[model samples]
Target chain A: MLLRLAWRNIWRNKRRSLIVIGSVIVGVIATILMDALQNGMIHQMLFNQINLNVSNVQVHKKGFKDKKDINNFISKPAKVETIIKNQPHVKFYSKRVITFGLLSSTDNSSGVYIYGINPSQEKSVSIISKSIVKGKYLDASDGREIVLSKALAKKLNVTIGDKVVGMANTPSGSIGSDVFRVVGIFKTASSEFDKTTVFIPIVSAQQMLNIPGKIHEFAIITDKYENADIVSKALQKKLGKKYEALSYNEILPLLVLQMDLYKQLLIIVNLIIALALIFGIINAMLMAVYERIREIGVLMAVGMKNSKIFSMILIEALIIGVLGTIFGIIFGYGINALLLSGGIDLRWFAESLSSFGVGAIIYPKISLENFIQIITIIPLVSVVGAMYPALKAIRLEPVSAIRYV
Target chain B: MEIIKCENLQKIYQDNGVPVHALKGINLTINKGEFTVIAGPSGSGKTTLLNLLGALDKPTEGTVYFNGEVLYKKKRRELSRLRLENFGFVFQAYNLIPVLTALENIEFSMMLLGIPEKERREKAITLMEELGIAELANKRPNEMSGGQQQRVAVVRAIVNDPDVVFADEPTANLDSKTGDNLLNLMQEMNEKKQITFIFSSHDKQVMERAKRLLILKDGLLEKDN
Candidate 1:
């Protein structure tokens, strides 16, 4: 009977009830779309950084990360490479002889982070080969090939096949300079990375830096980033000593921090929207209570309990929330489907996005967990919204209420 | 035997920080199955006494004895249950739930008493059939006439077999013929069902049909006979 009364009461003013229901639908859909877009943005950013700039995992000497001293290069490169090759989870691995150096082209010299990579293995591990704009990637056995980013090539007034002099401190504490011809030019989303970094053949870098057979890092790509942590931990345990294996997130904490920050902001935004919705519901219900004052008085005079009145109003809130959530899920998924297929183009902000190494286009994604979580929150918002109105309703004085003119 | 008795009943209404005395030092007793009327002019405390007797309000300084139990001392929830179990009320307006059908309204109080749906529906239909308004069972209030609505209200008041039925200006909105018909129906219910009928009204037809009349003037009882 209470349910019936509540159900009928909401329909007493269809427009008013529909307004609340509509607001809930709009709020939930907005929440879902925002969550999906932010998640997609974070997902794309992580994907680009891991696949192009940081590999899923990297193996370094124990003290190498903190100091980055040339002397901290891997101790047993050959043995670790063999163990890594046997691991099925490892999709590709490349040894890098990394060093901070300066590159000069006849007139200009700029400080650059240099990576000496095995061309063939690196082709499979990084996006550099595919990102090439001019000339060809390095030969497998080449000893003197180099690739310069478009930004760096421009900064040094050099282009493809131009001669550039690389200078760095040797392992023996002496300065060494070598001239190499750029064989290719590549561009990445981040102009800063392009302007500040270069790559050379592993043999050429080993000889120039005076670090023979000792690579500073072994960057590895896994079948999936999801499996990277387990593989990294397993390899860390297997290697046992002298080497520390780190997943991409652990190696690049800044990217992970940004992702977490986006998630937190999304939650706060959702909470604010929900709070407003709850208040909206409360206001609507209070109006319903006020309009039906005489009816409520009649009900009370006939023998309805205060708890029954409170529960009926609360049930009305639940009904509104449930109805709104259903519509919200439908529209949220509908918009997500359309957006997922074509993606939301932020190409207008391409330049700004490129500066941070993030893609301008985002494909909104909705996870089942997040969808269920939002669905569950709607009713709770409704209940919270209904609280004040329900209390007001049960507190009516039947004696005067029945005589209300 | 006394079914209801009130001693030194006093009611004060605080209107805008000024005390408006709606009832002052009135005492009364009502026996079972009596067709009683509390007759008064406007602002003469007729409705105030009805509200107190129906367990709808607590007197400022008085106790009401209902079936030898203290009505004013019971908690609000206890009062609600007592009202549901023993009393029914009909206000001046046809206070039918706008959303409900005639039969649904009739079965409302009984349904709240935990009566099963089938039993309540059967009883509602039987009562409507007896009142000759069975055809109006599925029609909401908007579809019913004033007289038909009042008839449904009367049926609802006694459908639960309440010990007492309280009506406050129940026929005020009806025409003279409908008012007489409604009074005739209430008199029948009192005689046949052995239910006490108490009314707060200034209607001549109601006063004429009353077996006992308690008249009030200026918030004070002038006569009870």
Candidate 2:
């Protein structure tokens, strides 16, 4: 009966109730969509990093990560490959001999990290093969053929079939150099990565750098990106002391830190919205209580307990909050579903986004965790907002209230 | 048998730092099954005395007893329980909770007493039938006429079968014919069920129909019969 009374009382002034409900609806929708956008952008950045060349995990021969010296090569490649193949989570692995060298053309010269890759093995581990912009991917049969990023190709003033020389120091302290014809040009989300990296057949790179059968790193892709740390740990434990197995997070600490900072910013945004919503609910409920002063007095005079009165007000606010949250979820999820197909285009901010390795179009991802959290929180906030007004209603003196005009 | 006893009931007010006495040392006793009127002009303490007797307000310098129990000595929560179980009120404005239908208003007091819904509903409908307002059962206070709202208020008061039903100017807002009809209904309930009916009013109809009358002048009891 108290519930019935509360339910009826709210509708007595329909406009006021709707205003409160409207504010809650706005708060819910704002939180949901903001979280979706942020999550989408972060998810894209992480996915691009993993897909490009990082794969899920990387194995370096101990000191190679700190210094890409040709002497720090993996001497026992066969042993590491055997152990990696035994791991259940390993989907694919590519052996690469990586060294920082210089590439020179007739028009320009730039320093680059030349990746010595087996074409067939690299195709399975890196998305560079699929990101070919002008020419075909690297092929095993094409000796002295190189894959250059479009930015690097432009920087060198070269095109497909153009010749460039790659030069690097060998273990014997002498410069070893090779002339290669650019067979492919690719573009990626990050212009920086695109301009600073080049790939060639492992045989040709070993010959050019004067090292044979000496691997530098093995990039491994796991069955799922989320299991990268576990797979990296297991491999690190088995291949102890001689190798360092690093997950995507360990390999890109700055990116991981930025993602964490974004999540914290999201929490702060939600708190601001909640604070504004609390004030809205409190103001509306206080007005409602004051409007019904005489009625409340009559209720008290007729023997309704103060606690009952307090609960009645609280229930009214809860109903308003629940109603608004339901509509907000419907609309929030509706907008997300509509945008999930084509995605929201951030081409307007493409330069800034690509600097962080995020694509132009972003698909908003939904999490049931976020929805469930907001669903429960809105009504609890409504109850909290109503506390003051409910207390005020209970504090009125019945005798004076009955006579209140 | 005495249902209510008041002793030297003094009620004072502070109107802008000056003490205004609404009631001054008036003693009275009301018996069971009595239809009584406390009559006076404006500022004559009629409503103040009624509020004291009904346990709606505390007296300035005295105490009230209901069926030999000290009314004001109990806690505030206990007073609420006492009112729910033993007393009912009819205001001059026909104070039915505007959100509720007439039937709901009539069942409200019984609901506070924790009566079963079916029992309370049946009791409310039966009382509405007795008062001849059963057809207006589903109408809210705004939808009903003044007379109909007041009839609903009266049913709400007595539906709990309280020991006393207090009516403050019950007919002040109605036409003569409607007011008399309301009075006739209360008079019948008082006579048949022995529910004590105490009223504070200046209306001649209420004064003439009372089995006993107490008149007040300038916050003092001037006559009693």
Candidate 3:
């Protein structure tokens, strides 16, 4: 009977109930949208970083991470490659030689990092060939051919079929210089990579730098990203102290750290929104108690105990919470779909984000877990918010309450 | 048998730093199955004494015994429980819960007593019929006339079958004819059900229906007959 009374009481003032429900809906929608956007952007970033830059895992000389000089290379590449090929989880691997060199073409001269790879093997790891904007990509059989980023090619006044001079330090402490024909111009979405990297054939780089039968780094691809750490540990044990295995997280710690920070920030934002909605609900309930003062007095006077009065008020709050949460979830999903379809445009702030190698358009993606959290949090906010007003009604004296207008 | 006894009861109100004695050493007793009226003008300690007797307020001094148990010695929660089981009340303004229908308002007291729904509904319906407001059972307090609302309030008070019914100006909001009818209803219920009916009122109709009258003047009992 008390439950029936409480349920009926909520609809007695339709306007007040709507105000509270509206606030909850707004709060839930905002939280869902923000959470989805953050999750989507971070997922996109991690995907790009792993596939384009650091293939799930990479193997380097034991001390190469601390100092990537001309001396750090796998001396016995044939044996290490054979071992990696035989591993069960290892799906693909690419041998690459990375070094800093100066590029010069007539009037232009700039420092650039060169990545030398077997073209066929590199293709299995990254989509660099598909990113070629101008000219033809270098093939494994092509001799003395290289690919330059469009930005770097433009700065050096070099094009396809044009010869450029590259200079780097050799293991013998002597300067190695060579002439290379630009066969392709690649365009990475990130400005940093587009302006600074030059790709060349691994054998040609090995011969020119006088490091025959050696490779500096071997990027590995696995069946699943979550198994990267497991495969890396297995590789470390198999290769012994000669090689060090690094996962994507270890290679790009800043990105991983930023993702963690984003999660915390999103939680705080959601809490603030929830708190604001709860305050609005509390305000509405308090006013409701005041408006029904005489009614409450009458219930007490007719032999209804103070505890029953308290429970009835609490039940009213519970009903409000359940109704508000149902509408909130619906509203949240609707807003999420709208935002997801119409991607957010941040072209004006592209330059600012470009500094961190992130894109302008942010796409929001929500998971089941996040949706469940939103649903759970709203009801808790309503129930907790209703407590103060219910207690206030319970504390009211029957005489005074009956006298109130 | 004495259902209510008060000994030298006192109640004081602080009015802007001055002590105003609302009840001053008043003594009274009410017998079971009697229609008793505590009659006085406004601010003559009738309501104050009624509140103390109903266990709604703590007396400034002395004690009240209801059915041989001292009420003032019980905890607030215990007192509330005792009041729920032992007393029903009707106020001057016809305090019917605006959110509930007339039938629901009467059934609320039985619900607090944890009575089963089917039984409570039958009792409420029977009481509403007895009070001649059975047709208005579905109407909210605001939807009914002042007299109809007051009668609903009366049914709500006695629906729990409490040992005592405390009514503070039960007919104050009704017309003279309605007020007279309401008093007669209380007297009839007292006679038929053997349920004690106690009221604090200045209304002549309420005073005339009383089998026992306790008159108060200047915060003290002046006459008892």
lDDT leader: 2
In model 3, which runs have C-alpha deviations exceeding 4 angstroms?
A1-3, A75-92, A234-241, A302-325, A367-373, B116-119, B122-134
* Model 1 Cα lDDT, one tens digit per residue, B66-154: 99999978899999998898998888887998999999999998988999999999999998998889999999999999999999999
| Residue A202, candidate 3: C-alpha displacement in angstroms | 3.1
Q: Which has the higher lDDT value, candidate number 2 or candidate number 3?
A: 2
Lowest lDDT 10-mer window, candidate 1 chain A? A365-374
Count of backbone collisions in candidate 3:
0
Q: What is the lDDT of residue A264 in candidate 1?
A: 71
Per residue, candidate 2 scores C-alpha lDDT tens digits across A1-405 of 888998999898999999899899888988898888888888888888888878899998997777888899988899999999999899999999888899999999999999999989998998999999998888992399999999899999999999999998898989989999999999888877888899999989889888888889999999988899999999999999888999999988888998888777776777678778889989999999999998999998898888889999999999998998998888888877876646889899988888889888987876565677688788888999999999999998888888988
Top-DockQ candidate index: 1
What lDDT, from 0 to 1, does candidate 1 have? 0.88
Candidate 1 residue pairs in clash (backbone atoms < 3 Å): none
DockQ value for model 2:
0.73
Model 2, position A116, has a per-residue lDDT of: 90
Task: Give the per-residue lDDT digits (tens) of candidate 1, residues A313-347.
Answer: 99999999999999998998888886564788898
- What interface RMSD, in Å and to 1 decimal, does model 1 have? 0.8
Task: Please write out the lDDT profile of model 3 over residues B115-214, one tens digit for every residue.
Answer: 8989999999988887788999899988999888888877887877788999998888889998888888888888888989889999888888888899
Provide DockQ values for all models, in the order shown: 0.80, 0.73, 0.52
Candidate 3 Cα deviation (angstroms), residue B172: 2.1
Q: What does the lDDT read for residue A69 in candidate 2?
A: 85
Would you list the rank order by DockQ, best first?
Answer: 1, 2, 3
Q: Model 3, residue A274: what's the lDDT?
A: 74
Tens-place lDDT digits, model 3, residues A223-285? 998888888888889999989988888888988899888877776776788788788878988
Q: Per-residue lDDT tens digits of candidate 2, residues B57-90?
A: 8999888999999899988899888888899899
